[model samples]
Target: MDEVSYPSADVLKLTYVNVNPTNINGIERSGTLYSLIGDELKIANAVPGTRVFVYTVDGTLLTSSTTDTQGCSTLPIAGMSGSVYVVKTSSVTFKIRKL
Candidate 1:
C-alpha cells in the first residue's frame, strides 16, 4: 500500500462503553473491545494497520481510519469532548475511563 498515514492528536473527546458484566464465566474474551457510543472504535488495543470506524453518541458512524503500532490512531472524532477513554486488554476485558 502506497498510502501515507498521519499522527494522532493528543486531545480527544473520550467516552466509554460498559462491557456486559459476568460472574461465573468471568469477563475474559479475546478480540474484545470497548467502543465509544455512536462510534465504531475500540478504546484500547487500537493497533496500527487495524481497521476501525469512528462514530457519534447517537449511533452514527462518523469516520473510518486505521491505527499505528504505538496503539495510536490516525483519525479524529468530530465534535468530541476532552475526556479520558481507556480499554483493558489484560485478563479482564473492560474499558477504563482514563483522564
Candidate 2:
C-alpha cells in the first residue's frame, strides 16, 4: 500500500493575478453600444436605418434587424442563456455575453 499526504491550504488556494484585459476577439470598436433590458438587448449609438446582425459564437446568424431613428434597436433574445454572441453592424463587430 502507498501512503499520500494532502496539500496544505496555501498550496490548494487559488492565486489570481491581475492581468490587463484585452479585446482579442478581432472585433473592432466603432463606439456602438448595447444594454440589456429584461431579455432584450437594446443597441444604442447605431446609425439610424442601418442594419444590425446577431450571431451565435459559431457565426450562425440568429437574428437581424434595423435600428430605429433614435439610433437604437431592441433585439428579442429571450430564452437564450449562457451563450456568447457577436453583434455586428456595417462598421463594427463586438462580443456580448448572456447570463
* TM-score for each model: 0.31, 0.67
Per-residue lDDT over 1-99 for candidate 1, one digit per residue giving the tens place of the 0 to 100 score:
799454558545555576555535555454434455443344456444555554443445555555567554534443555543333222342332322
Evaluated at residue 57, the lDDT of candidate 2 is 88
**Of the candidates shown, which would achieve the greatest TM-score relative to the real structure?**
2
lDDT of 2 by residue, 1-99 (tens): 899566685465655586546836454665678787778988888789979889998989998889999888889988878989998888877788889
RMSD of 2: 6.6
> Where in model 2 is the C-alpha error above 4 Å?
1-31
Off by over 4 Å in 1: 1-47, 69-71, 81-99
Q: What value does the lDDT take at residue 55 in candidate 2?
A: 97
Give the TM-score comparing model 2 with the true structure, all chains together: 0.67
- Model 2, residue pairs in steric clash: none
Candidate 2 displacement at residue 16 in angstroms: 12
